[model samples]
Target chain A: MEADELLVLVAAGDQKAFEDLYGLVSGPVFGLVRRVVRDPAQSEEVAQEVLLELWRSAARYDPGRGTALAWVLTLAHRRAVDRVRSARAAGERELRMARRANGPAFDQVAEEVEAGLEREWVRRCLDRLTALQRQSVTLAYYDGYTYREVAERLSLPLGTVKTRMRDGLTRLRDCLGGVA
Target chain B: MTGFFRRGDLHSLAAPYALDALEPPEHKRFEKHLKRCDSCPAEVRALREDAVRLAWSTAAPAPAALRDRVLTAVRTTPQEPAPVRPEPLPRARPERSPSRGRRSPFAPFLIPLASTTAAAALVVAALFGVQASRAQDELAQERAQAREIAHVLAAPDARSTAGRDAEGQGIAVVASASRRAAVVTGSGLGTPAGERVHQLWLMRPEGKPRSLGLLAGDTPLVATGLGTNAISLAVTIEPAGGSPQPTTAPVVQLALKSVGFGE
Candidate 1:
């Protein structure tokens, strides 16, 4: 069954279906959380929380609303962003940024290898966006920066950044038509 | 669709909002705007589809042990109860029989009301109780109103559209044609200037606009009979008691789309 059907069963408190859902979604959930949170242990904790939340709020999932994968990823992304926005991560963010600036070869190698074919598709779509649009989209989604923070980072007007984010996503939506 | 106010300004935030890039205040503000935006939900849904692909692109295998921990937690966690979709309301005339089966969610606070007069009486009592500072009864009325709002929101066919005044104050209507009702909520309307009040009007395909009610601060107004040919919803400033007709031009006017009722 598709993820949508699995989610419906999960909503009915089907444990076996949930196990299947975990198999389908855990990698993307953990990977997205890890990208934003960056700490291995913390990412694990957040990912666990997200997975638990899916089981807890499964019934609220409306099949008419959108695809189940989209729903699950939204929950994962929001939770990851919430973690980075919290007070504890305020200090860790600078450290993560410093680490990112140094661009450790090991992390880069691991990321490139693990990213797989999905990353190739996203990278191609992303390349179609203007340089500023790509930067705005990435800094916010991957870095968990607020739009204002993105504007400051990019040295662009807040309005300009907001438009770019909207335009960029619209372009991506068109380019990746029907993929989700 | 007005030009200078940049009315679409807040609507443009749907992308950032979908990406989870908005900070708390902007996040809250945009969320309020989103509920009433007709095009926004679909737009946000599409963008989210793309956003998830971004999440998928970075997919890394989770630790094998983490699965055991999550499954263990799931075994003990109770799932939220799914929303109860109320039985189809007994069909009543769209305009005259406003309150018949509509209070299904509030049946505990109120008996299943049938007569329009009795429901009207409860509304009057609910209003007078508020004025008389009767706490317990007022509480019940508030709960009923809240549930009524929730009922419309939870309706499977609920559709939202939003409009803003020239000064940027916004109003959004979430209407469910099947329920023949709509909930109107606004942000930044601010308090009407001394003794004046904000009034709601539902314009039909023909005839003068009908007064829905007076806006009570931030409280959402639940108006029924959306199945009627109500073409647009307008808000205008009026005298404290409200006008028989709009005394002033509408500050916010959202054109209503035909929400098809499922027979």
Candidate 2:
């Protein structure tokens, strides 16, 4: 079913519509959110919230934005960032995050999101970033970090981190289009 | 990185800074520039689109059970699409309809919480009157209240953000598209002291901060209006109710814009 029709059904409480929407958009939503969140178990939980949020907010979906996929992806991004920001601020959550950063969930997420031209392109562009730049931008843009936090985390000058992020994103933007 | 600036560059590249794609003082500096720069505003839009695109880049696989979970959640929960309006009962039913339970002489007292809803309505009326009296405003000095009301009564922000409140404690709250948006109660906020209430401000990049509303003591602050088009929610310690504007500095500033909603 088309995203619009499925959304209408979702508004009407059609579980089938939700399932269909999930099948269609979940991968991108999950993948994008996972990159920022970086914890597989928590990623799954947040992704679930994002999907459920879509179901609940189906009535709010307007076709003008893009596709149902794009809409869900936006929500996923915001939620992923919120999770990271809160966890970091809470202090304890960051400790937990660091401990789990290298857990099996990352592998699982990689397995789930590893394909397609766009993904391949993003992966390639992401690879071109220096280790610190990649980590900072991934955390700052993808994870919603304040520059101060990203700088502190990487133990780099706030200025250096900022330049890395700007340059890194500019490269990604140019790679993706004439535009980030 | 500095080499990118060699080719007639003068920090014009700071437009993507909204995505935190730029660094500190420059980030602060460009923010000042964003207000007067129309071209930069358009550039900000492009950068935001890019950010949104990056968000959609690799699709992550949702849990297998997500299908079941979401479907089951939607299925089991009743959708009150419109408030259920029961069709007029098949006019003139027998007094003792067997399907609905045997009618007895004591049926008068057994209102079943529905029959006397009309009489019980007095309770609702009284409740509304009290709420109206409490929530009603007496301050005639407030300006253009209608437009402001629209901004305030908007559905309590449905979106949520993770950040720290003024006290630097963890908080999750949603800001409206503007400071006047109706705020649905979230899990944060407590009463501040006399000369110290929760002051809401819409912090524009370079412009003087516009005051949204206040979270006073006792009354639930959830429904208060937030600054719309607000980049961040800054709560300050001002006099009871709130300052005509912020008198002291912001105690907490949560940048909801970074979460990409404002984008």
Candidate 3:
């Protein structure tokens, strides 16, 4: 069933529909959270919270705004970022310092791996972006770094990072042919 | 940050805003702008769809257990009643002054002018008030979470370990014996395939391996209820959600060491 249709049922208090929605979304939600929050246990916690929020806020779902999956993923991403930011603020300075010292070289391993058609297309689109643009977008989106953080990490001006992100996403949108 | 946004600046923010890349204050400000700006909303919607595609590219199967947990929660948790959609504001129609027959031509323009002024004021007031209060609540919640983490880190007897995965991916853990909590941080672990995720495990000398949780990204993770008996920790590449048992060899393993209050 369409997520929107399922959400309509869920909004009306349909447990079965909510279950269906969960099946359709939990992976993406969890995966997205994992990408931002990194820790297995806490990722699970954040994912659970995002899903529960979905159940509670299903009534607020507006078809005019976006699809059910997008809304759910957005919520998951926000929650995951929140967890990361809060942890950073909570005296994890040593850990953050360690991470910065051992920064991951953003590689194409993720794009090279075997995947479905949609994933391949996404990778292909991402590949088309300039290295700077790709890095900026990936750092901000998948890594959950704010634009300002991305700027500091890349040692570029904040305006440059913002422009790169915006331009990169615009190109990606065009490359993906607006299918998503 | 609380000033009027130029048209170009507002339009440019649609992508970052859609991707949740903006700071909280910027995000909230853009959202308020989004409500009144027709063009930007559609742009944001499209950008969000693109992000959804990106999210789909990394789709890993969630843990089987999570399904049950979420469903159980859904069944037990009361569903919020659907919100009553607010009625659309009545259109501003010029009220005819009956006493002034054959009204001056300027009167026609005057009524709409008055109505438009009132509607604009109402919208600005309502939107600003709602957004400001919501931002404050969010800020408060964030501060609370930060305080909780601070307390955990400040606990005495906090032991920590740092190591690297086989692929040279960095992983670190800080555990507080008093709080029975630990936070794991990972880096250089690139995005896993759509079907897999890196899972962290807490291994004891004797009992079955305990799943600490799964990493979503290269961020810090908090694990609670850490057992004193856990002798070591290991991470492995497993199917998304995670596995009932380790499905692959450990990517990295580190022995837990006692500190300060010697074990």
lDDT per residue (tens digit) for residues B1-263 in model 2 = 22333211334444235454344444445554554454554444345445554665555556678667766776656553522332111111112221111112231222232333322233234323435554336433222333343343332332334443334332334324434343322124566655566766655322346676674432223434333223345566687666665666555545443222221
- Give one digit per residue, the lDDT tens place, for model 2 in A1-180: 545568778888777777777766777677777777777788888887887777766766544332344455656766787687778677745534342221112233455553333344455557666666567666666656666666766778866776776666666665443211
Per-candidate TM-scores read 0.56, 0.44, 0.56
Quick one: RMSD of model 1? 21.2
Please give the distance, in angstroms, between residue A29's alpha carbon in candidate 2 and its true position after superposition.
2.0
Off by over 4 Å in 2: A1-15, A65-67, A95-112, A129-135, A142-144, A154-166, A178-180, B1-42, B76-263
TM-score of chain A of each: 0.86, 0.69, 0.86
How far in Å is the alpha carbon of B182 misplaced in model 2?
47
Candidates in descending lDDT order: 1, 3, 2
Top candidate when judged by DockQ against the true structure? 1
> For each candidate, what is the lDDT?
0.66, 0.50, 0.62
Candidate 1: CAPRI quality band: acceptable
**What TM-score would you give candidate 1 relative to the actual structure?**
0.56
